[model samples]
Each structure stands twice: as structure tokens, then as C-alpha cells.
Target: MGSDVDFVAYVCEQAGLGGALSYRKMFGEYALYLDERVVALVCDNMLFVKPTTAGRALLDTVEEAPPYPGAKPHWRMDDVLDDGERLGRLLVATAAALPRPKPKGPKVARPGAPRKR
Candidate 1:
């Protein structure tokens, strides 16, 4: 029920990163994605990032929690950002790690193909 477009934009803007980002409704919560791989989410006004193993190791030395209960937490860079450079680096890293998705095209039928009965 919440508008995530703005939230996602805000984060992307603040981080100075951009790409073909989009969103879809999932189980009543909004799931945000960069390219095709999920990147983050806005739940209850708190932003959470997808936990990549590499990203996990980055913060493993510190304690962290999932964005929401009963689910995995976003990459916690909140406490570590004493300046914009650190935050931007974290965002860019995650953005770069995201897998680029192949373009999905519309289904087509062969010529003279029989119609469904």
C-alpha cells in the first residue's frame, strides 16, 4: 500500500547510482530490483538490501539485522556511513554485483499454427 517508487528514487539519488530499476508487488510488500536481481526494499520506511555473500563478509565483523522480521536483513551500511563516499561505495558495489537479466520478449507462434481449441 505504500509508494516505493519515491523511496527507491531517493536512495538511488542519494547514493548517486542509477540504472533500469523497477518494482513489483510481492506478498503485499514491495520488492525493488536493479536490472533483474532484487536489490532492496522499503518496509515501514526502513530500507533493506539483498544480502550478497560478499556483502555479508563485508559486515560480518559487525552485528546486523534484516530489514523486516521473519526475513533476511538488508546490507547494513547505515551505521558505517560517516560520509557520502562510504555510502556511495556500498551502493555502487551492490549495484555492480547485481546480475544483468536477459530481455524478455513476447511469445510468438509459427505461421499456420493451429489455434487453441
Candidate 2:
């Protein structure tokens, strides 16, 4: 079953990272971002945080599971949802440990559009 919007909203609310926290719907699920870095995924009403040494160390207990089929295991964080402070800290640490996303190249001009002078 697809993830519910309410669940996604609850997860976001519980994370409590302010403006830096955002989520995008993907394939009927949700991807959680911290400072523009994808730190977790919410699928089937479950939260799957990307595995990082810092995140692992911060968690009270670790459980690994894939957010979707054919994906690498992540730190299943559903149990931590209730504690907003810990969740926020874990997300920040995960984002910090993850590398920055690559910069996108300029978009290609449309075939019918005029080229830059």
C-alpha cells in the first residue's frame, strides 16, 4: 500500500528540524531531506534513514531494512519517531556525514529556442 500523507506529515513534524527539513513525494512514498540532502525515506508508513557512522552511533538501537525493493539497507528509524529531539539530531548527523550532492549542469536549450548570442 502507498504511504499516507498524514503519516508523512507526522514524520516531518516529529523530526522538527525547522526550515531545513523538507520532504518530496516519490513513487507514492516520501523522501526526507535535511539541508537539501536526502537523509531518509518514508515508505509503507515506515522511516528508513540512510546509514552513516554518525547516525548509527547516535541511535539507541539499530535496525536495518530497505526502503524499497532492490535498495540497500538503511537504518530503520520508526521507533525513534516519537522523540523529536533525537530524530532531529540523527537527521542532522546523517546529513553532515553524507557527501554534498553534485551540482547540476546548465539545462540544454530547446531545439526550437534561439541559442544564446
Candidate 3:
């Protein structure tokens, strides 16, 4: 089943980060980003944060699970929905530990393409 849009919105609001936070639909799931770095995923109404040392240290307890089949284990943040402060802190720490996103090259025009008049 696909993830719920309302759930995704709720998760983002709970995080309460001041960075460039956003999400993209991928294969019926959602990929959550913080400051252009992917921090978590919302799949089937569950929040799966990347397992980082910083994030793990912030949480009181750690629970690892896969967001989808055949995926690596992630820190299953089931309690974050009701705790905005915890969610925010987790996201901030995870984003800080993650490497900056690589720059994407500009798209090239097709060879021998006609120029506009």
C-alpha cells in the first residue's frame, strides 16, 4: 500500500526543522529530505530514519527496521509522531552527520539541435 499524504505532512511538522525540508514520492513511498540531504523515509505510515551514530545517540532507545522489503535496517521512529522536539533533534543530528548532497550537472542540449529564432 502507498503511504498517506497526511502522515507525511504530520511527520514534517513534527520535525520542525528550519532547513530546506521537503519530500518526494518514490514508488508509492516518500523520501524525506533536510537541507537537500535525505534524512528519513515515510513508508506505509511509518517513519524510518537513517541509522547514524549521531541520531542513535540522541534517541533514548533505538529500534531498527526496514521501511520496505529488501532494504537495509533503519532507525524506526514510531514515537516521534507525538514528540516534536525529539523528532526535530533527531533530524538535526542525522542531517549534520550525513554528507552534503553532490551537485548535479546541467543538462546538455542534443547534438545538432535547431536553435530558436
Best by lDDT: 2
Q: Candidate 3: lDDT over CA atoms?
A: 0.89
Could you arrange the candidates by lDDT from highest to lowest? Answer: 2, 3, 1
Q: Which TM-score value belongs to model 2? A: 0.89
Stretches off by above 4 angstroms in model 1 are: 1-5, 25-28, 56-63, 80-85, 95-117
> All candidates: CA RMSD in angstroms?
5.2, 2.6, 2.5
Misplaced by over 4 Å in model 3 are 108-117
Query: Which runs of model 2 end up more than 4 angstroms from their true locations?
Result: 109-117
Q: Rate the local accuracy (lDDT) of all candidates.
A: 0.60, 0.91, 0.89
Give the alpha carbon lDDT tens digit for every residue of 17-60 in model 1. 45555567665556666656677766654556666665555454
lDDT of 3 at 104: 92
For 1-117, candidate 2 gives per-residue lDDT tens digits of 889989988888998877789999999999999877999999999999999999988977888988899999998887799999999999999999999999999999889998888
Query: Which has the better lDDT: candidate 2, or candidate 3?
Result: 2
Cα lDDT tens digits for candidate 3, 1-117: 999999998898887865467899999999999878889999999999999999888888888999999999998889777999889988989999999988999977788998668
